[model samples]
Target: MSDTLGAAVIGLGMMGERHAQLWAELPRTRLVAVYDIVPERAQAVADAHGCLAASSLDEALAADGVDIVSVCTDDQSHLQPCLAAADAGKHVLVEKPLAITTADCDAIIAACERADVKLMTGHVCRFDPRYVACHDAVAAGEVGDVVQVFARRNNILASGLRIGPRTSVAYFLGVHEIDLICWITGARVTRVHAEGTSKALASIGADDSILSLIRLEGDAVGCIETCWIIPEGSANSLDARLEVVGTEGRVAARVGGEPFEAASASRSSRPDIVYWTEVHGRVAGALRDQLEHFADCVLDDTEPIVTPAQARHAVQVAEAIHHSLDTGAPVDL
Candidate 1:
């Protein structure tokens, strides 16, 4: 192992591409290989990054100098690649909600544990400065005796059309808030009652929106609103916010309401500046910070910021949400 860790990324979707690019761009890691279900996609990314286009997951993990693997596959398909990466003795960084099911999350976590390698689930919001600042304030006792939390993560109609069929909006978007609420408040979700409605994505047999009322371990309550039916013409593709109210004070963080905007004759847009954005020809923002954090953790042999257990908790809550939606009753964890 040199000073820099070598990286491999499986899956070549939008998020996967970003992972590959960041691995190539970051100082502590360099892209060594990339693999995708589609050979052409893998080849394209490898060509652009000057890395190996692995023909299979085995090849990607076996590539010379590959020390870390980024499992950027879809919500449901995370288990296999993650297990393979761990078995190959490489560190793993997977995208959230970790997996659509708690069982899969556990399998991945166990595999990494057995292999004695680090595992991190990419709950990118934790790396966001605003979210981090909010968490810090809460931890510092600025928010005394948290009583309630409210989170909203709404995306454009295009997102629903693109991802609704593959997975529900709750796992795709709601999990971020689920994890954040528990992390910021330092309480586990004890119960969840959820309801969903579908119209725009009904044709695809997917819910257009889901609202969940959650009770934390200390009787703290939370409301989570996740919808993917916002019009694409909206200035931002994503609109998200989180607020924590306590007996002494309240802390809140807002996303998608960025001050910077660009307008042409046809439309105006607010590009994401916090999550994944280009600055001076390189990837910058929370996602980059997240990747760097994982690399540094692996290099230093320290625990990742987003532990496997914490990530699994988010998946467990998501499963409970779906169960509540199915039974039309509250599901106690």
Candidate 2:
């Protein structure tokens, strides 16, 4: 095998395109093939990147030089591509919220395990410097005995309008915090009491906002706020914050309020510079770091930082949150 791995992206949406671009740009990986439900979309991406525009999932997996598959399908459509990738003997790097349900998550995990291939979910928050620093501080005892955690991730109305019709806000946004808080505190969420409102996305059968009160394994508690109904005039497309309060001290990270702001006649904006951004004519940031990490792990034959079980834990917690919302009562895991 060559030192550089070849990658295939299975979805051509925003995230999938980013993955394809990064694989082409990254040092240890090369974009070899791409596939989307729309052949024209796949062709456009392939033409831009000089890769094959596969007509089907099997063709994409079988494309010459392909070693890894990046699954960036919709929130509810991750299982089939993941299973197919494993069957083709390729490593997988899937986007977060591994699946909408725990059973689907298990099936994907089992398939990869059976094929003896690497599997890593794309929990990009884990790769964010802000969250990484906070996790490190808590792990270093700077925050001593965590008592509680609070996380908020809100996006502009455009996001709600674009994604609400397809997926719930909890799975789309809250799952990031669900996985992040558990990772930072090193505890499992034991129970959850969740409530949701549906003013903005009610017509689409999606919630505008979801708030979850979570109890962890060690009795530490957390509050998670996820909404995508912020007005477009807001300074940033994303508004997120995470704070961990401990017996001795506290640590927190804030987004949407970056100092780098650009103002225009109509509105002032703070464009995203952390997740994925064009820098020096190429995509760079946490998302790039994440893809690089997955490629490196596959090349070195090592386990990924974001393990399948850890990803499944997030789904389990999400399921509990939905259950709580349905029952209008606290649910125990």
Candidate 3:
């Protein structure tokens, strides 16, 4: 690879466009090619970034001078593009929920290992400033031995469609808190008790709300509440609250309206949502930071921040949550 890494972005949706924009501006990366199932989307992004728009994944994979690939496609379609990148001897940075299933995640991990390629998942919360500050505070014992945690993610109907009806709230929003709780406390989830209900948007076959309680390895417990019941034309939003009650004292971080205000409102307003402010601005910055970190890891042969094994654990927890909902019983990990 040259001093500037030649990067290709697969999938030109919201996430993909962010990646493309970041690569265009990143000093260490160059946008060589972009591939999307939708040609117009691909061309629009590519033209804006001054990059080639590949007609197919194979073309993107075979494009000359490409050394890194960002797999920004949907959750279910992550495997093939990642495997192709690994086979093509390119480093890969895949978006989160590594895959829809554990088996598929395993295959991608195995292929990357066998091919000696670096693979990093897009658990961007690990890089978020607020989350980073909270993690540091907890690690420094500012929160003492975290005994309990409460987290929530809620949004309006428009934002809910991003995850789609086929996927559960646990995988889409809960996964971030799962990773956060684990990362902050440095513990593995031992068991999960969960329940879900859908009073709205029944057309998508998705739960309108979900609540889960997780027991960690050290007996510390965490709770997650996720809902997609915010009405249409409402502000797009993601509200999260983290309260860590420890042996000494408690520390909490919140990113939404106050409880009283939230209670008064029918649903969260858009003012709370902060992920995609300038379309490609924040997310693109995070994606660039993540991919650059992965590139450094590949160059230095170091372990990635979020390893495949960790991603697998996230998926396992998600599965456990789903199982708990189905069996109406706490599922042991």
**TM-score, one value per model:** 0.99, 0.99, 0.90
RMSD of each: 0.7, 0.7, 3.7
lDDT of 3 by residue, 182-214 (tens): 888888899999999976766777888889999
Across 79-113, the per-residue lDDT of candidate 1 in tens digits comes to: 99999999999999999879888889889999999
Give candidate 3 regions above 4 Å deviation.
Answer: 232-236, 256-285
User: What C-alpha lDDT, on a 0 to 100 scale, does residue 242 get in candidate 2?
Assistant: 99
**Total residue pair clashes for candidate 2:** 0
lDDT of 2 by residue, 1-333 (tens): 699999999999999999999999999999999999999999999999999999999999999999999999999999999999999999999998899999999999999999999999999999899999999999999988999999999999999999999888888998899999999999989999999999988788889999999999878999999999999999998999999999989999998777889998999998889899899999999999999999999999888999899999999999999999999999999
Which residue window of length 10 is worst by lDDT in model 1?
A: 300-309
Ranking by lDDT: 1, 2, 3
Candidate 2 structure lDDT = 0.94
State the displacement of the C-alpha of residue 147, model 3, in Å, after optimal TM-score superposition.
0.8
For model 3 the TM-score comes to 0.90
Between which residue pairs do clashes occur in model 3? 235-270
Error of 3 at 248 (Å): 1.4
